[model samples]
Target: MATLFDEPQKFPLAERLRPQTLAQYQGQAHLVGKNGVISKLLQSDKVPSMILWGPPGVGKTTLARLIGNHVKTPFFTLSAINSGVKEVRQVIEKAKTRAGSILFIDEIHRFNKAQQDALLGAVETGLITLIGATTENPSFEVISALQSRCQIYILQPLSPETLVEMLENAQKQDEWLKKLNIKLKETEALLNLSGGDARRLLNLFELVVSAFPANQDPLVITNEWVLSTAQQKTVRYDKTGEQHYDIVSAFIKSIRGSDPNAAVYWLARMIEGGEDPKFIARRLVISASEDIGNANPTALVIATNCFQAVTMVGYPEAEIILAQATTYLAASAKSNASYMSIKKAKELVRKKGDLPIPLHLRNAPTQLMREQGYGKGYQYAHDYPHNFSPQEYLPEAIAHTTLYDPGQNARENELRKRLKNLWQDKYGY
Candidate 1:
């Protein structure tokens, strides 16, 4: 019954299929379903400042636009990459006139501290509602003060089922796509290549559909066709964008979780995405000390050497070295005893506020200082049997406080025994 002119006009499949309302939006049911938090918020008059943290193509931007449309309020968008403080101020100034206006910033993690600071007043004064979208962890990227003012909502990647439903919906809703006698032969290739990105699934699907002959009555979509078509188009991974952080996070977590296969795959993704070899090597070094720690001190040595080797070799050869280091670290026993110890120590320092060092533990460089009792009672371990002495190293205020708790590993278990022998009940080792 529909006329030819009523067919969906020329546009990217993703764009043409973008959900215009909450009812039309697919996936993210936990947030947008009938009883979802966002759905409840939409029912109210006041919309709070929030950050949408998720992977790419998960509809962060679309959700923001949909909220604006639902509220019937003025909506403005800016990219953190290109917008400076001046542009931000301009937007804020304009927002003042339009009460309850929403300002959406894409890739907001890229905004520096100063740039983020510019919006604090506007957000606090309720002049503009801030909606920030980021793929990076907001705790690392957003300043604490700003983060305190906004609610952070995490968006999940689309599942294969959701993605397949989206594809079906697109084919059903889009007139042009409906007209095409398209049959999906296998969905594995499409889903695997999309990596749970709905937009990518649609775009790749469109590309494959375009390859068919104009008059082909029944175009069958197969895994082979999707793979071949996708290969012909270079899929760029922006090393400086959201994908960069997502991939790196995956790489580090993979190592921490002891999955060498995953670690190598994520490492390859970074390498192919043109990530700096130094950056990759640096993370490996940190992981060595933070995750491997005393469980395998040799891990740090190997990681450090890998860094040096990668720096000297670079690129093609560096990847092999990285792979070796990644696999080794993933296979090694993991511990965060040292990492946790430092954190607890730092917290104690902040709480205690520079407690005075015990006089015996102080250095006596001059005769006058020695007369004042500096280093007067300090034990000389060399003079004692077994070159060990139980002495109060901590200040008088908190002398008995225990900081380091040896992790349950071969190396740390030995350390626990040695510490127990030296300190007795001073530390509950």
Candidate 2:
């Protein structure tokens, strides 16, 4: 009996329940709350160009749409995936005709420098209020000029309470979903699978409900049902996209945090999702130096070997190599001292504008150079006791500065003692 005009039940649960206004929006209370910056902006007439940076399904696009609706502006949406520079120009040309228009670009981080540049004039001239949505870090992906013009607002993942509330709201608001006699017996599986993505959570919930037999009286949502249904509908992880970066980040952080179990879990996720083995290996190698450092120098060797092994062996077998490296890095005593010291040293060089190298430390390759006092007083450390000379090595301007602060780990502790003994109070070891 369904007519063309009749409400279609085929629409996705998430789409059907999409918030029409800011008032109905479920999460991001920090942004939409009474005194929040976004709320304040909405209260006013002016809608500034902004980039909403957050995880997937945190409602960046929804917020942009709500802002357009609230301001009653001509709204145009373009996806960075399919849209190019040509499309960007077309949109801007159309916006020029309208007095006040809002251009929303989803996955804006995917836009190339040239495509993003296309938006600069429109956003800068106030021809179109640009609202960009990105799941990736904008600093890395967005060009400086375009990024400078737009305000960045960070949206956090939906909390468990907020997610549950969203689910309840869907049941209450959606006529089709409301018709079912449903009870949520468990939510941990749903929450775990969603990974704080609101849209994915709703879609998974719908899939579970649809699995129930029509003759079944009460629809029971359990962890088992959710897991089974989810397995059948495999989780969509785009290895070349946002999820790739997210999983790699988690993997690196797990090792950095010294959680072998978590490190291995994320590594497995990447491997199973068919992520490039070399890419994962490269990150592992970086983590070995940056996070593990001098706490276990062997970690770098192991990570390097793992990378080579994976490159030679390839996947199926490569997963084992990656897992081995991941666990070793996680188990090793961690330190960022070496990494931080290099960063500080680099910063000093940049600030000091290449301070002159000390005369004593300079190499006197020829007689004329030696006559100019080059390497004149450079103490031979091998001739000194303990093969150590407490001499000035850094540029004269920063000679007294201590860049390498040894961490408190056992190995670095010994290093600290040695440096302290050699330098007395010179380097403040």
Candidate 3:
């Protein structure tokens, strides 16, 4: 129930100077430049339903307010964490009575399937322009029906230059800050410690500034003050929040990109953040199956066993099992052939719908099925020398549908050669 301004000691400069218009906003040049999407929308006097996807403290909530201001529409904000279906419907009904409305939902991914469905009717009929912000991947978190109705734009972290620029602007422009004789000695340490978070960087600057004795002719803001300020604030790491997803993303991408240094750095991040060892182990299992599949069949078994070991024996002992899996996965030859294959297969299903099963491959589970000539011409591969049949498995309508092309890694090179002997024409092996 405490107002932000009531707790200025805790809120700091960034919270105090949140941009009310797009013109005053910095960063996200991709979305708010002269010809940016929001800028163009302002020029045309129209705004569309949109979802802003990004990490924390990237000004998603501020941008929503900017959009509403530019369009001159009523802005109704909701947090998906607490707002329910009843609240959603009430907002939608209220939006219909207004000339135009922009419903801004923060952490929109927290909406369950039912809560999301409640917004469909209003969005479809243009009762409100919905702007949803989420830290999670919208494709996985948002309902497909709702996602299709909104244009998703990604926002990124403020670059070091941008963060420094903000600090310079505050020093030069802010009334309170300008009164102080603050001089930045070194920004490298501050920016690095801020971790590319604009809000944190600015708040740290204010802390160091306020800590200065009021009448000093030249207030020297050094790395030591910044470090000291950071130590006063104990950041409780949320295992399920921004840090968790960020660490896992870095960890997986590191293993995928073959950067052992980055992989281990993220591994240490997760461990220090107190992430569940079994959860890390499960990702390794999936990484082996999806990324290292077929390329090294042994990787799957190793990762699976590693997962079981971690489950049987919890941390800190499980950290060793995780390390062994991480090292092996990092060292193993990687291929995404199977991953791409399944993706392509799912896409084909969506595009082609359900194609008829080939009569030769259909099971003759009953007399009527056998009478329909099911399994009449099916060939048993076991009767032959090799356990493979040179027959088509795809539907007759799309008989030549081919997926699963092996990559040029050492393990997959052997697979490519074997596939060449098995099905020569499909892959040009």
Q: TM-score: which candidate is best?
A: 2
lDDT of 3 at 9: 56
Off by over 4 Å in 1: 1-9, 233-236, 240-250, 253-286, 296-410, 416-429
lDDT leader: 1
Ranking by TM-score: 2, 1, 3
lDDT of each: 0.87, 0.86, 0.82
lDDT for each residue of candidate 3 in 1-429, tens digit (9 for 90 to 100) = 322223245446887778877778999998899878877877998777889999877888889988888878888999997899999988988887884588999989888899999988888778888999987779867999999999999999888888888888878766677766778888986786666777767877776676655556687878887777667443434454545655687799888877777787788888888886866887899899888898789999999999899989998999888888888888788899999999999999999999999899999999999999998888898876678788878897777677888887888888889988987777578
For every model shown, what is its TM-score relative to the native structure? 0.69, 0.70, 0.68
TM-score of 1: 0.69
Point out the higher-scoring one by lDDT: 2 or 3.
2
| Counted clashes in each candidate structure | 0, 0, 0
**Residue 62: error of model 1 in Å?**
0.5
- Note each model's CA RMSD in angstroms: 8.8, 8.3, 8.3
Better of 2 and 3 by TM-score: 2
lDDT of 2: 0.86
**Candidate 1 residues 297-366, lDDT tens each?**
9999999999999989998899999999999999999999899989999999999899998999899999
